[model samples]
Target: MRHDLRPGRLVAGLALILTAVVYFGDAGDAWQSPWWVAFPLVGGGLVVAGVVGVIARSARRRPESTPPADRNRAT
Candidate 1:
């Protein structure tokens, strides 16, 4: 079976993965992160996801254009 693409989910998933990676690195002492960094990261991700969803929905809702009929074709 085939499924429709969802950009919002894709962005949200990527953002979550990135957040986890950052937190994991910090926990392992690989790097230091400010305590409140995740807030903006997740918030921005959600906002971007929402915008993408809206755009995708609008694009899908638009009617597809058809090519003009040819009048010179032989009968």
Candidate 2:
């Protein structure tokens, strides 16, 4: 079976992994500071936004078909 991932999902997954690293790595005392939380939060938010953008773009790119009423009527 083949699996395909949307751009947004890919980005979100990466952001999630990054968040885990930041939370679990415990780099130093600095990382434990409140300000350190901002990094992963911002990154995750951006990834989510990216996913939304990808979905929106894909929706817009779909072909528009003539309405059924118009198709049956004479031009």
Candidate 3:
């Protein structure tokens, strides 16, 4: 089956992965950062917002199922 395309999810996943890589790579270094902590927070928020957006978008659309041929058209 084809997967749903959502930029939010993609962005969040990538951001989190990048964060992990950078955080781990700098483990040996003594450098510290205050603004660097925002990466994970943004990633988490993106994921939540993406899921909510997908749910809302789907909910707003009409169902695609059609009536069977045997069903009467005239009332």
Candidate 4:
């Protein structure tokens, strides 16, 4: 139920919107930049963002329990 807009999904959505514009608006000819280029470019960006997001999220996550020896030392 976590509906957060993570980096990967956000990139995917943006890419999809751009694809619609390129294909439906006939922007391909206007831009003269191969429409197919969007897929790989967006895909790569998505991967990079996903990796960075994961690394950041994990770093921000709450720390696990203290070391086992500390735990056994009891209060």
TM-score of every model? Answer: 0.79, 0.48, 0.41, 0.48
lDDT of 4 by residue, 1-75 (tens): 665446656665776676667666565466555657778757776776687678767875645776667755744
Q: Ten residues in a row with the worst lDDT in model 2?
A: 26-35
What's the lDDT for all of these models? Answer: 0.83, 0.65, 0.65, 0.66
User: Per-residue lDDT of 8-54 in model 1, one digit per residue for the tens?
Assistant: 88998888888888899999999999879899889988889889988
Candidate 3, which segments miss by more than 4 Å at Cα? Answer: 28-75
Pick the lDDT winner. Answer: 1
Clashing pairs in model 2, backbone N/Cα/C closer than 3 A: 8-51
Clashes of 3: 0
lDDT of 3: 0.65
lDDT tens digits by residue: candidate 2, 5-64: 466665666677766666665655435635468576767668686867678678856345
| Model 3 agreement with the true structure over 1-75: per-residue lDDT tens digits | 786566556667776776665666567474554556766567676777688668867875555675664354543
- TM-score computed on alpha carbons, candidate 3: 0.41
Better of 1 and 3 by TM-score: 1
Ten contiguous residues with the weakest lDDT in model 3 = 66-75
Model 1: number of backbone collisions: 0
Ten contiguous residues with the weakest lDDT in model 1: 66-75
The runs of at least 3 residues in candidate 4 whose Cα sits more than 4 Å from the true structure, single-residue gaps closed, are 1-5, 24-29, 66-75
Scored by TM-score, the top model is 1
Q: Arrange candidates by lDDT, highest first: which order? A: 1, 4, 2, 3
